[model samples]
Target: MPKIIEYPKGNFKNSLDLAEAVSSLGGSCDRESCAHKMGLKMSGAFGTKIGTTAKYELITTEKGKLQITELYKLIKNAYNDVERKKFETEAFLKPEVFNKLYDRFKGSELPVGMLSKLLIREYDVEEKQAVPVSKYFIDGLQYLNLLDGNNNLLDYNKSLEVEDDYAEIEDENDLPIKSNYSSPYLPEKPTAQILHIENKNNTTNRVEAETTDFIVHIMGPGIDSQIVIKEEEDLLIVDAMLKKVKKKLQ
Candidate 1:
C-alpha cells in the first residue's frame, strides 16, 4: 500500500508572507471596500476553494522569517483559476455592454472626453476612438488570458477610462509657440543694402494681386506667407527703417 503524504500545514509567518505575495501580485485585501467588486469576489472565491477558513499561519525559523511556500502555492493556484473564470465571463458579456453604451452615446450631447474617462475608469481602456474600444471589448471577450495579461486588474480599455486627461491638457499648455515672421528677407552673411517690402493692402487684396511675389512657407500640407528675412544687410536695413518708422508712426 502506498502512504499518502498530507499537504504541509502553513504557519503564521508563512501565511503573512503568502498574503503579502498575493497582494503584491495585485490582489487586494480590501474585500468589500474594493472599488472593483468583481476582483474581491474572485479573491474570496479563491480563498474558499483553497480551504483557507481563517488567515494562513505565518511561520518563523531560527535562520530568519520565512514565507509560506505552501500557502503561496495554494493562493497562486486559486488566483489563476479565478482570473481564468473572470476572463471568460467578462469576454462573453462585455461586447453587448460596450455596444449598448456606444449606441446610446454616439453623436449624443455627451462629451466624448467625459465619456472616455468614465469608460477607462470603469472598464480599463485607452483608445482615442470608439471603434477601437469596441474592437478591444470583443477581443477581451474572446481571450480570457488577456484580462490579467500585464499585471493589470482590468482590461486596457478600462485603464483608459481611469486615465487623467486633465493632466495631459495641462502638460500641453506648458509648451511655447514659435513663429517664423521677420521684417526683412535676406541670404546668410552680412551685407550693406537691405531691402524690405511691406504689404499695405489686406490679405484678401494681396491674394488677388497677380504680380504679388507669393512667398509660401510649407508646414506640412498647409502654407504660411509670413516672410522671415535672414540676410545680414536686410536685417540691418529693416532694423534701421523700423526705428525710423516707429518714430514717424508714433
Candidate 2:
C-alpha cells in the first residue's frame, strides 16, 4: 500500500478576507433605524438629580466605508488562500488515486461520458451502470491482475506444507503412491486504516462565523459539511488500484 501524505493547513489571511467581503454588504446586521447613518454608536452621562435620577439618550454615528471595504478585501484574500490550500491538500494526499484515474482514461479513445461513468464507478462503487458490460470489463481487469504479476506472468504458487488427513489408497499390487494434489498459496491482502482530524480550538472561528453569516444572508440559511477525507486508508486504496492497473497493462 502507498504511504499517506500529510496536507498542510491553509493560511488564515485568505479566510479572513472572505469573511470581511461578505460582512461589508450591509443590511447584514439589519439596523433599520440606523440606515441613514453609515455607523452606529451610543453614549450617555450618569448624574444624580433630585432622588438620584439619571438621564440617558441614544446617539447615532457613521464609520468610514473604507474600513469595511478594507476588511472585505482582507477577508477575500484570506478566503482565496484557504480554498487554494484545500484543493492543494486534497490533490497532494490523493495523488496516486488521481494519477491512476488519469492513466486509465486520459489517452484512451473512450467517449467523455463513458469515461466519466467509469471514473465514477471506480471511485464510488454505488454508482449504477446502465449496461453491465463496463462492470464486467472492470472485474475482468481486476481478476487478471490478481492472477498475474508485475511482469504480466502468472505468479508461481507455493504448496501448503500442512499434513494431509485423507486415507491412503493402494493399487491392486498393494503399492502406495503419493496423490497428485496440491493447494495454491494466496498472497496476503493489504490492510487499511482510517484517521480523522478535528479542529477543537476554533482556530478559524472568525472565518467560520463570517462565512456562516454570509451564506445565511445570500441563501436565507446556512449549511455546512464538516466531512474531511484525510486518512491513510485512501492512500492504501490508491496503491491497490495502481498495482492492479500495472498488472493489467503488463
Candidate 3:
C-alpha cells in the first residue's frame, strides 16, 4: 500500500504533460540529462515533479538512473487505445489526493467555489492555488472517464472496477491519511455556466436570474436554508461580500 502524495505542481503541467514526459524515453536515464531534455530547469520544482512521478510508482531510481517501473512501461507500451486507457485510468487512482477525495465524497455534489475553499482548510493550500488544483482534478478526472459528465468519481461497481494491478502502484506514505486532515472540494474557475455538480442533491448550486427571481441555498454547519434571490440590490450585497472575502485572501 503506497502512501498518498500531495498533488504535484511543476514542469509537467497536466496529465497529458506528465504522460508525454514519461513516454519520451525508455530504460534508465540520468536525471540531469532527462531534466535537460525535457526543457525544465534543474530546480526543486523539477525535482518535485520527479518526486511526484516516483510517488505514483511511475519511475524508480536505481543507483543514479531513473528507470520506468514495469507498470509504467506497461502503460506506455499499451497494446491498443483501450489498453492505454485502462492503464492510464489505473495510474490516476494511485495518488493519495484522488483516492482520499473519492473515498471522502463519492456521491455528494456541490459548487466549485465551495470545494476550493474546502481544499484551503484540509490541505493548508492557499485559496488561489487550490482553485487550479480543483480545476485540474475536476476536468482531468472527467476527461479520463473516471468521473462522469457530472464530475463525480465513478464507483467500484461503475464502469471502472478496481483492478488487481492497482496494488502495484506503490511508494512512500503507504497508508490512508487521517480523516481530520481533509477539506471539501470543488474547482475555482468554471467559465461556461460553471457548476460542480455530482448528481447528488446533498448540496445544490445556483447562479441564474429568472427575469426578477432567483433561488438561493445557504449551507453552514448544522444550518441549511433556501432563500429566493430576486432584488438587484441583494445581488449587490452578495457581490460586496464576495469582494470582502477576496480582499481578506489578499
Candidate 4:
C-alpha cells in the first residue's frame, strides 16, 4: 500500500491565522494552549487546523508542542509585501501534494473539473479527502494571487507584463525555475553562480545566487520597477530602498 501523504485540511488563510495565533504565544507552546489562544476547543477540528498549519510549513509540532517555523518567521518578518508574498508562496508550495500539482499545471490553466480526480489518482489522496484538498489548493492560490480569473497560473513571463490598472508582480512561485535569459543589465564578465539550499530531507528549502551583478524586480499592488545591481556597494542602496517599504503587519 502506498503511504498516504498528509495535506492541509484547512484553507491557506485559516492555516495562516492559526500560525499567527501560535506566533502570539512567543512562537511555541503546547497544542492545547495554542488552540485555546485561537478560541478553538480541543477537538478533532482543532487538531485538523494544527495539522494543516504544519502541512503548510508555517508551523511545526514536536512532542505536543506547537511552534512557528523559520519559514513563518521569515514571512512574519518580511521586508515588504512583495517579500512577504514570496515567502508565502514558498509556504504554500511546501506541501508535497500542492508542489506536485504546481509542477504539473504551473504554466497552464488548472483543470477545475478534474482536480479532485487528479488528486485522488495522482497524489494518493483518499476519495473523500480529494475534494477538499483540491478546493484548498485553489483557494490558496487565489489567496496568493497566483491564479488568474480564468484559473490560469501566473507564470514568470506573464508576471513580468504590466497591466494598466495594477502593476506587475513577479511570480514568486517561479523562483525555483532558473531562467537562461541573459539581460543586458547583468554584467558580462562573471556568470551568476546559483545555489540551492536544501533541508535535511534533501528538498530545496531556498534558492540563492552568488553574484554581485543581478537584477532585482520589485513589484506590488501599485508598484512596478526593476533595479540593476552592477556594483557590490549598490546592494546597500537597494537594501535602503527596501527598508522604506518595511512596515509592521497589523
Highest lDDT against the true fold, candidate: 4
Q: Looking at candidate 2, what is the lDDT of residue 106?
A: 31
lDDT of 1 at 184: 17
Score every model by TM-score.
Answer: 0.17, 0.16, 0.51, 0.63
Residue 95 CA displacement from its true place in model 1, Å: 9.1
- lDDT of candidate 2? 0.27
Can you give the lDDT of residue 12 in candidate 4?
A: 89
How would you encode candidate 1's per-residue C-alpha lDDT over 1-250 as one tens digit per residue?
Answer: 2221221122222233345543453543332322132344535553432222122222122232233344343444544334434333332332333434434543323333354455545444444543444444434333433223222223423322222121232221121122222221222333332112234333542333453332222121111233233332233233333333343455
Q: What value of lDDT does candidate 4 attain over all alpha carbons?
A: 0.68
lDDT of each: 0.33, 0.27, 0.51, 0.68
**Which of candidates 1 and 3 reaches a greater lDDT?**
3
> Per-residue lDDT for 194 in model 3?
16
Please provide, for model 4 over 4-86, each residue's C-alpha lDDT reduced to its tens digit, 9 standing for 90 to 100.
47777889899999999999999999988887888889999888888889989898898988999999999999875556877
Query: Model 4: how far is 215 from its true place, Å?
Result: 33
TM-score of 4: 0.63
> What TM-score should be assigned to candidate 2?
0.16
Question: Candidate 1, after superposition: displacement of residue 153 in Å?
Answer: 24
Please provide, for model 2 over 1-250, each residue's C-alpha lDDT reduced to its tens digit, 9 standing for 90 to 100: 3332221122222223323332554413323222223333322211011001100001111241212233233423444333433332222223243334434543233333474365444544223432342333333223323122222212211210211111121111111121122223222422222111124344442234433221111010121212111332223233333333343456
